[model samples]
Target: MAQVDRQQWDVVVVGAGGAGLRAAIEARERGARTAVVCKSLFGKAHTVMAEGGIAASMGNVNGHDNWQVHFRDTMRGGKFLGQWRMAELHAREAPDRVWELETWGALFDRTPDGRISQRNFGGHEYPRLAHVGDRTGLELIRTLQQKATALQQEDFAAYGDHEARLKVFQECTVTRVLKDGGRVAGAFCYERESGRFFVLEAPAVVLATGGIGKSFKTTSNSWEYTGDGHALALLAGAPLLNMEFVQFHPTGMVWPPSVKGILVTESVRGDGGVLRNSDGRRFMFDYVPDVFKDKYAQTEDEADRWYEDPDGNRRPPELLPRDEVARAINAEVKAGRGSPHGGVFLDVSTRMSPERVKRRLPSMYHQFKELADVDITAEPMEVGPTCHYVMGGVAVDSETAAAEGVPGLFAAGEVAGGMHGSNRLGGNSLSDLLVFGRRAGLHAAALAAAPGPRPRVSPEQVDAAAAEALAPFHAREGAENPYTLHQELQSAMNDLVGIIRREDEMAEALRRLASLRERAARAGVEGHRQFNPGWHLALDLRNMLLVSECVARAALERTESRGGHTREDCPAMERAWRPVNLLCRPVEPPPADPAADRIRLERVRTEPIRPDLLALFEKEELVKYLAEEELPE
Candidate 1:
């Protein structure tokens, strides 16, 4: 066996997205030697692909908008399954974070008054997203990257060496979180370009790796989102919460096969785009669920009028939350109301003027024109649902972002669950990456600073991890292609357990996932490890299959339709299911109990909502789901 490079640090952060970068910065600020490791270039993490904006109660657009309203909207958008404390903190702290970004050189679009301008997004009570035209995410990542880089330069000068207080290890993939006893001691990582192993030994580790979107066929998430953090945490004995709640964002490009699942930003709808069926009828009015009744206009006249006078008229149904719109699109296509591309029409051409559409959403204009050869300023574009985000992740404390049952291990960003609950609203995701990312960094740094002996990784564990990583190359004859298995898994997830699921279909998905997992273990690849895409997929297949099982099992267990999870047989939102959060954990493989294998999923009733927060809602609303004993004054 080759010798693995070993390096020690106070903290190791897996992932280099908005969350991981923020965490690394905070960790370094707290005097911990930190490293941010990622599978791509520093600025190319999925954060840059976010086209909407970050949510914050800056009150630049509407004076009535405040943290409380933002908090309520976030809870409602998530269908109230999110952790109350995290939501509260995110709503309250987000404005400050956004403002701080401006100081760090985030040049956001401004109102006439020179205050940070905000934009409209689905489920937000007021226009609450702080943006930079259509490229808010790019500006955000740029600012953070510049700030972190400046700090890194300062550290390099101070140390008079290449090593800095905060370092970024780009194009590195972490395969395992090394554990010492019950606590995380470090992680096992490999450079993507070289495929050479490196053991990063740190007292504290933060898993900020994003989501599990690649489990499905049509996803907007990058290839890096193969459930690295989810699987790493689970293998380290941490539980994942609400694994079934996956968000399929509406309005992905559907015309061109090459760009089928590519995201078409919600900014189009926020900027006055409309959804129409093949007959040129506005169809969103017919699909509004009862839970969202009275919030959206039901008639074309009212919907059009609402766009001009949102204060007086109900908002248009086109501005409904992503989950609602995605399901509506699915239903329309099923009912033969789809366009030539098997999707509904998103028409901004009829609403916004050509100049306005081009100016406000240059990316969307270019994306459509270049990808599908459609001019959004002149015609409607074909759009449908795409697997966007997973609402479930490593279960963590709302305050600390500490992984359950795993000491010295924490998570944030999309990897940490219980923030968005059943479905995340637009703009909330960016705020989540900041609010919780900072918390995880601060807490992980503190954990590293605590008075104790530094955690250490055992040589035996290192050898085992290395052997496991190398097993795909040493497989005997008759091995299968990792890509083939990945395609099969994606087909299973897309066909059976997608946006609309059924009892029998989900059960079949579980059986298929089990078979895939078994087969993935025998995934083999040719050639050496260096820059080998096949070898990488062979490893990622394990994580995807494991996370897919978690999703399939939890979807089967949760009998009610809520938020992103819709069961055709169980369509109504059952109030009784509101307080329960299904928790997923993997037992030892091939257990004596068949049910005790990779995914031992079970429900854990969530802690009752805090009394003070519960008091914010109306009495009528509280009684709908909460018991008298659970409600507070």
Candidate 2:
């Protein structure tokens, strides 16, 4: 091969975020040697950018809140396109996951009786998010990292080396999932700083790389989220489930231009903020759809009363699911009711005292004061939709977290589809990380520990990955700039295939994507690989282009408006489309020319919802989302 340095482990994890760390912890505990690789510093994964709280049906805040209600809320939030089993599993197990964090030294904000205090969030029937001010994600990452270190400490005591069982490789990126025939063998990776290529040969690999938000112009994602995991899975012969469902969070910063698209946490709304238009109208009241009308307050008086007496009044329309709220903001902006910066106003100043605002949303308070020179406790902030989470990802078995058609590959968190369906409810993401991350690790460890010959890492595949990585450095004449190509790609996706969609716009998006893919082949970087950001971006462009094609292609094929995916031409939520999932699988023998279509889209029927689970919802409610054949007699 190319004299690449190689290390062997039982399980190799391709991310170091909350899910990756949790998976590593589970794998090591199951007596497997584990390694975690990430593109950022150990604790700096996009998980830290998650500002709200972890969703779990603990019922600490409201005794009536239980798994059934949470499950129903999840399915409804996804517009009933979510995989029912995954929703059931997440609802049932999330409370234990949250409580487990406490056992591992997580200090969550507590209630009067000293229980983990849960707060209200969009799409939930009750107060169900376990939080630590507005920085719950940071605390979750800290807790998982501590748990991993504690295991390492135990390993050091017995084996005389801290890294004897589990180790984390920070500032490293996995470019390929190496395979022997059809089964996973390991991963091909590169250290970002030294530009050195290496391989981690293992029987099993868990992909926990977050999402593909960076493919859009205005996004809440960090630079590292260039859809590496999604691309890796697709190239390795695993299909991505429904790449069309992209979430544009309703409250990204819209002013000062420099800080545009930075996330303003949903905690702002969950903790008392309200959305208003330029006319100083609480416009959310005017936008509630038929499905959610019964659950939300109809008037300002009722909405305000629900904050203190949630049992007596329905939640404010401001707490509607993210897809609904994002579309509402877009509507307000389009109608010329937008703020000076082209977004609606999100205000908390009139709702709470300054001290309470600072106490409940410390990170948000500081974020606005320092970044935008605006004190959130004194005035409303300019906010709009920005591309955030992707609901589509690697298709996997609901129980084992194992990717279908790929023997030893598994995925969890935002990289795995079907859990959130069409749109994820606020706060469900952190709990999803804990619940399924553990499942993937347990199953991956079991597979690695099986008594059988290990899959051999192919040298030919390793060499090919190395060649592809190096191609950007050696460019032909008239090569394109990586930065400029990336800008154009982001613009195309944001304008054509974003929060709302149409047949012609998405078709045009696919054409632009194909051209971008051709130019991306010639993407050139000026500097040497060592610590060169341009070189890094050039490598990242391949992944972005591949995933962008999946998004554009699948978005055009699925012709209905549901949750995060809104088709303007086909604006109604079609019950007939509820049972279908659109999968993006890579074309066999990928086209030799980069300009040719490389992804093939297929339609797969979703597994039927269990009868027992279906009974939880009122038949009248089920009729709205299910086809006549799917409904119970």
Could you say which candidate leads in lDDT? 2
TM-score of each: 0.97, 0.99
Local distance difference test scores for all models: 0.89, 0.92
Could you give the C-alpha RMSD of every candidate to the true structure, in order shown?
A: 1.7, 1.0
Please give, for residues 230-309, the per-residue lDDT of candidate 1 as tens digits: 99999889999999999999988887886788888898998899999999989899988776677788788888787888
Write model 2 residue lDDT over 166-238, tens digit each, in one string.
9889999999999988999999999999999999999999999999988999999998899999999999999
Please name the candidate that would achieve the greatest TM-score relative to the true structure: 2
**Residue 359 displacement in candidate 1 (angstroms):** 1.0
Instruction: Output the TM-score of candidate 1.
Output: 0.97
